[model samples]
Target: MTQFEALFDGRSFAAILFDMDGTLLSSIEAAERVWTRWAAQFGIDARTFLHGIHGQRAVDSVRQLNIPGVDPVAEAHAITLAEIEDVEGVHPIPGAREFVSTLPEGRWAIVTSAPRALAVRRLAAAGLKPPSVFITAEDIPRGKPDPACYQLAARQLGWTADDCVVFEDAAAGIRAGEAAGAPVVVITATHQRPMDTRHPTYVDYNALGATIRPDGRLQIRSQSTRKI
Candidate 1:
């Protein structure tokens, strides 16, 4: 009787969409390892560098670092390759298997900024195989915060954006869902900053124990709880 099970006792959602990196799989450690190695190559403090781009895309993160003479695209590519090679400590999120297993096959897909090859490698490392309809960075012209990924996912799932519930841990991902006209259930797995909880389409679930209802609502049963 975990808190999430209690909270999600009676709810129904049409379809569920998940974000791969932090929400469904714990890839932060792998990401940190790769990024730190890349930063060290430039004599930068890995910890400090990681903090500056914690929730951003690899390319965006590289740009922000403003490394003296390094090309952002090249740096991002290098980091991506390193991450693919060193995907240790990556595993499925708690309750991920059970939650995903309960959902109808083909009713959900992973939408992530990771390119196809890397995404596959990470999921494999996590011991989780995604369904057939995943939408990776390679599948979309734009990634999170652009709405393209979510929209494409919804389309592939044969559902309208309004009928899908997006699970994400990043602000950019939430915004992407909102932009795509989908309801977003945010899992606080990584970002520590306070999120804007006022938006009608946004809701936060305590990652300690949370579940997506069949109806698409997120239920989090903890001592302190409130509905969005």
Candidate 2:
């Protein structure tokens, strides 16, 4: 088990919120596949395109592609649809299903940048049927790094931001959670390196393990191993 797995031994956190893409579902490969195909149609380098917008919204990514005369919104929609249709090998992160099952049903929800359609597809692929309070890209006027998504989710859960613990795999999502005043837990799926530990409010789940206690406080246990 990772350090994160060990941290859940005997601590307490009220509610847990998760980001969908890299946090819970492995949609990076599927995303890259669809994005590369779209970039090729515009004669752009796929790797360059992917690196340039690794954590951006679809519309933001499309606009950054800088393809002359392209309608970013329409292109984003098309590519997103294509990605949903072509999705393969998409699955939940390790221990994700068990973790969710252990938590209180209404105490957890997904707050993701993916549109509802693609989110649904990816969640189904991961064999996860989330609670009804899912907050998608469609639900927010602004995306990650804006804190709107996290704020909306907290409101829907009827919990204050401080009572919520956010599980995120992206730097942008982490920032968003912090901005929303939630304690942020970094799930080390995509981001492998250790982040700055100066902030006490921010903890790496990769370093401390997590588990749901009988009382519903997420137990975070610190282990000998540094990496989660």
The superposed Cα distance between candidate 1 and the true structure at residue 197, in angstroms, equals 3.4
Clashing pairs in 1: 12-214, 12-215, 13-214, 13-215, 13-216
User: What are the per-residue Cα lDDT tens digits for candidate 2 across 95-135?
Assistant: 67766776667778899888899889889989999677899
lDDT of 1 at 184: 65
Candidate 1 residues 208-228, lDDT tens each?
A: 344555655444333443333
Global lDDT scores for all candidate models = 0.71, 0.74
> Each model's TM-score?
0.78, 0.84
- Alpha-carbon runs more than 4 Å astray in model 2: 1-11, 52-54, 192-218, 221-225
